[model samples]
Target: MGATKIDRARVADTALRLLNEVGLEGLTLRAIARELDVKAPALYWHFKDKQALLDEMATEMLRRMAAETAGPAPEDWRRGLADAMSALRSHLLRYRDGAKVYSGTHYTDTSYAEPMERHLRMLVDGGFTPGTAARAWFTAYSYTIGYVIEEQAMGPDPSALPSGAEAAANPPADPAPYDLGARATRLAGHPLAVAAGEELFTRHDPGFRAGLAAVVEGIAATLHPDGAKRGESGP
Candidate 1:
């Protein structure tokens, strides 16, 4: 027989399931304990409070994300970095509100270090300065989080423009007043975006990949100083 487990990992897994089912707003120690068929105080033996549980879940998710992107590649640091962000975007979409879980969270934890270190080293090998590499990481990382949040906010639907057809059919007739900020750059002179603009308004992998590529390319332009010559060239 397999040895019985003692650590709180199982409780964390169960709670994450609850999070997926109900969402962050509904996750609680008492609810998770009920899901696991254990009393609430039993959970206390493992986690001190809700924040502790959220931390554990966040760590687990990051570990999985890191594992998905680690590997050898001869192409260049940019492809590797892009692949890493793609994996993150894909995995987060698997769960409701996953982007929110990862945004601005602590990444200095030793567990999250290996993947980050690898990416930074790869960037350096590709001729990026340390400060540039760090900044690129930040830019790409924030883009992933921000993009995924917008992806989640857009429910799955035809109106969520994956092809520009929707936007063409439903262009806001007038320059409408958007709330304080707009998620997409007002689609005005962008062609690939115009030709395939629907992706911008939808929850999709292609759109996510395109946006991440744009952020990474933006970082490349910042680092190399000449990459900017081709600004707004489809990332």
Candidate 2:
């Protein structure tokens, strides 16, 4: 293929596919080139290095998220924030190690601008000052990223736990290690700690939504004490 034929989008697409196959650690310029039926040098023409390619892949992921979630902004600021966050979580969960891939990469591409502007506008119109709106966005974004990272680390079945009988029969060789059961016992006397431990060890979706709701409520309290009653006019 000609140099002009290899674009950043193509490279990003290949990298995303490779992400599912070999995961983030195995995704490399050489591997992408091999999948593309091109030499490693050919990929360099598009991306300067692996980080550059990874950035584009992250950008592509966001672009897809924007496309998938595109719609009329919800009139309710809380609803708008919830919808955006839900969309973000869904997209991040689509690929293996996707949260790790997207956590810190900056998208230099302009395609992220429209969705970003829309999200900010949603908050700003909902009675948040421009500064507060930006902060709210970042706060919610951080929560979503962190939640997904932990969720991914726990694997697909968040409820998978050793039974009490199983644990008693086969105790760990090293008792001092971080054990969920032990940790739960330590927090048993504290209601809040027990609730948090339940949320952490059990299903993550409800907990994620609950946490997002709390974040939104806190932001609303800070920016609009009246809960932005009239802030749902437009976006």
Candidate 3:
């Protein structure tokens, strides 16, 4: 039998696995090539460089997400949008430093054409104006990407807080890492937030959700003049 010609996706999958074990810093073209049992030059023939390969991997992961979540209904746009963001967050968090691969990268690539078409069509059918639809899509994209970037960089959720009594009972005399969370808790001052202090810092998804909802709602408001009047739609 002749020597096997490896698929480009096989290379990418192996690279992602290496990312989980050794992380972004240790990832390299040569390493992936080695893992795939191909020559480094062969890998370069498929992807021009490190960033190019990473961008391809990110795009591929997103394509997988779109395949799983690309369904539409005018009445269901809000949940559809939320589900898309949630899926994207989960995929990026699946590998070590996955967000690093996606941050500041292009997802508007031709390989993403199908999902792009689906997303835009859903927005249009949801009664969004052209500008409003574009803004909503971009806003959700930015918020999700940014949240994941910070999520990986910070190595934990930023929203976590301590119990109120626990916070008050053992106030640190000196500056402490937990001090920031405590201070945020005091500053937030919402009744529900105070009651859920320990649960607050668990994840960044809620903040991201709130932000996307606001953007989607704002866009919907402008697109459907009666949206603020009716309150049953989103971009």
Query: Which one is best on lDDT?
Result: 2
State every prediction's TM-score relative to the real structure. Answer: 0.72, 0.77, 0.69
Please list the C-alpha lDDT of all candidates, in the order they appear: 0.69, 0.79, 0.70
Per-residue lDDT of 160 in model 3: 32
Tens-digit lDDT track for model 3 on 37-63?
778899877888998888878877777
Candidate 3 displacement at residue 70 in angstroms: 3.6
Cα deviation at 29, candidate 1, in Å, is 1.1
Winner by TM-score between candidate 3 and candidate 1:
1
lDDT of 3: 0.70
In candidate 1 the C-alpha lDDT for residue 91 amounts to 79
In the predicted model 2, the residue pairs found to clash are none
Model 1 C-alpha lDDT per residue in residues 1-235, reported as the tens digit of each score: 5533435788878866676677777888899878876678878887788877777778888877767765764358788788778778777866667787666555425788787788888887887778888888878888888887876665431222233686568743321233212323565566565544444553366667677777777777766444644564545
Q: Lowest-scoring 10 consecutive residues by lDDT in candidate 2?
A: 171-180
Best by TM-score: 2
Winner of 2 and 3 under lDDT: 2
Against the true structure, candidate 1 reaches a TM-score of 0.72
